[model samples]
Target: MKMNPLKVIKNGVITENPILVQCIGLCPALATSTSAVNGMGMGIAAAAVLVGSNVVISAIRKFVPDEIRIPIFIVLIAGFVTVTQFLISGFFPELDKSLGIFIPLIVVNCVILARAEAFAFKNGALDSLFDGIGTGLGFTIALTALGAARELLGNGTIFDIKLTPAGFQPGLLAILPPGGFIALGIFMGAFRKYQERKAARQGKPEPVHAAGCAGCAMSGQCGAAAKGGGN
Candidate 1:
């Protein structure tokens, strides 16, 4: 199928952002986003795996047995994640230490596996590649913003660069686990409101593609629920 490249890109980044819209990969988003640098590192590392797995899976979709498709996808994602882990450890030791288990944990990251199964398994190679990139970028952008917000409020700095005045007291909660959830909740709410306003302006409901949710890790559950609803 000939998919519009621009639309594919826009869909991942805006229409259905992996983090903001689908709410996948919150583990890393919450855990690693204590600072902008940490968040960016995690994002790029995952993006590398996401793009590679998507391309390889799409290329071999026809040959992979339906029964073993999930296993094969996991292996492919693991390979990419391993490679990414090595590159980060070798060149960016500080970030490697900061991310720690999360780096290796990317192998099971829902965002990567979900895209491989739902998108690459069904789409052409080129489109799948773009989808991976777009999704990766969206994921990266979301983490960066989240991290920046937390860092600024928690540490009175962003990317380790001081911005707040000397007397400014940093919010301890901003850097804690509770803060991540709070920040994410606020972001999700704002995103939904923006979509709603945009739809209203256009005089139509915002378009939601099931394919977007299909790429979510909870797709199986979602599908089952949808079927039950239809019955």
Candidate 2:
């Protein structure tokens, strides 16, 4: 089956952004997003894992057993995550130190694992690659934006550049973990509202990919509710 590459990429980056839409993988997003650079670093590492794991999983999907698929996916994702951490620690020691434990935590990030089970396991390698790229990019964009917003407010600068006056007093809370949550909530709400308005303008209901959701993490609950609605 031929897949529209643009559509697949757009789906991951926008229509179904893991952070803004699905709201998966928030731990690192909040922890490492105290600055734009940290957010970008974390995002890049996760993206690498996503692409590597998705391609391998899609390529081997046919040979894997249904019962043990999750374990197999984890093993593949772990391998990629290990490689990513090594590359970071060796090449960008500062970033590796900043990310620290969260770097390894990518192994269990719902975004990567969920994509493996939901899309990669069922799609062609090329399509899966694109999906991974899109998803990773989306995650990166969200985190970077959140980090930048927080850093700007807290430090009165963007990515370490002093954007405020010499005597400016930053909103100290914006640089803290609690500020991360506050920024995240605002971002999520704004994105959803924008999507809703766009849908309304197009004369379409809020978009919901029911078919895709059927294979997603929330599938069991969503599927049950769907069935109940039918009956």
Candidate 3:
């Protein structure tokens, strides 16, 4: 099948979103989203790993045996994560420290693996690259949104700069792990409601179930039996 770059990108950004939709990579999503800077740093790091791993996986998909495909993908992902970790440490030590173990943890991120297995394995190099970029950006966007919300409420600041009135008292809970779960849940719920309302407004047909009683022998007289009985 020919790969469509636009479709691939769109999938990562919306349809197959790794964060708000798919709910993958929650570890870093929660841990690094305390501030915009930290969230952006982690997102970029993960994006680099995703893009590199997707390209490598796509290039080797034809030759890889299905039995060992996952192991191979893991190795490639680990290599990219290692390179990213070193580069961040050498050039952006503060960010590296802020990110901590999450950098290496990128190797195990399900979003990267899901893309590699579901998209990259079947796609050409260019298409896989596009998918990686889209998915990475989607992740970054979600993390940034979460971070902004958390930081604003938790510290009364956006990027560590106070924005609230002098008398404002920060909500300490917003920066905690519980706050991450709460924010994510609220976002997901709201998104789902929006989709439902949109579908209703568009007059979309309800989806049919293939496993309904109409197709089952227990529905009453079976199709064959009904015809034969009448005959």
Candidate 4:
């Protein structure tokens, strides 16, 4: 199918971000984002795999049987993930170790699989490549920003470079699991608010969130509340 490369790129990076906006790949986004270096490394590795898998999938989309498409996509994604893992291990051992299983785990990451099913399987190879790059970059940006924030707050440093003044007592929670959740929540909220403000400034209606708490444990309550408000 024909697609605008620029629009695909923009959609993945900003309009439909996999991490900050769509909220996919939260597993790695939260687990490996304790530092900027770790986060950036993970993000870049994932991006490489994404671009590779997207291109391959898009190229062979027509021939693949619809019934077995999921299996084929998994294999393709797995291959790319394996290659990315080895590359990182050979070139950036520290990051490789820090990311650990998460690298290999990219094979099963919804971000890759979702893109394969939603975009690559339907779009041209070139468009799929751009989509992969855009989404991957967006993922990278989110991870790096979250990592930087956590590292700075938790250790008074970013990428292990000390930034705070001497004697600064960093918050231990910022680098811990709790810190990850809090930081993620804060960032997501901030991004949504920013989007809202931007839309307002441009005289556009507020963007309707795609997920809209559908995956939350409290989805039932959320639905009820929405209906109540509507009434």
Best by TM-score: 1
| Candidate 3 clash pair list | none
What local lDDT does model 4 show for residue 67? Answer: 83
The C-alpha stretches of model 3 lying farther than 4 A from their native spots are: 205-231
lDDT tens readout by residue for model 3, 11-128: 7887656776676787899999988888888988999999999999999999999878988999999999999999999999999998899999998887888788877898888889
Task: Look at candidate 4 and tell me the lDDT of residue 193.
Answer: 98
After the best TM-score superposition of candidate 1, give how far the Cα of residue 52 lies from its true spot, in angstroms: 0.4
lDDT of each: 0.89, 0.89, 0.83, 0.88
What pairs collide in candidate 4? Answer: none
Clashing pairs in 2: none
Cα lDDT of candidate 3 equals: 0.83
Give the alpha carbon lDDT tens digit for every residue of 1-231 in model 2. 899999999999999898888888888899999999899999989999999999999999999999899889889999998899889999999999889999999998889988998899999999999999999999999999998999899999888999899899999999798999999989988987899899999999986632434434556777788878763
How would you encode candidate 4's per-residue C-alpha lDDT over 129-152 as one tens digit per residue? 999999999999999999999999
Pairs of colliding residues, candidate 1: none
lDDT of 1 by residue, 57-154 (tens): 99999999998999999888888888898899999999999999999999878889878877999999999999999999999999999999999999
Estimate the TM-score of every prediction.
Answer: 0.91, 0.91, 0.85, 0.89
Summing lDDT over every window of 10 consecutive residues in candidate 2, give the lowest-scoring window. 209-218
| Ranked candidates (TM-score, high to low) | 1, 2, 4, 3
**Candidate 4 regions with alpha-carbon error over 4 angstroms:** 212-231
Query: Which whole-number lDDT from 0 to 100 does residue 194 have in model 3?
Result: 67
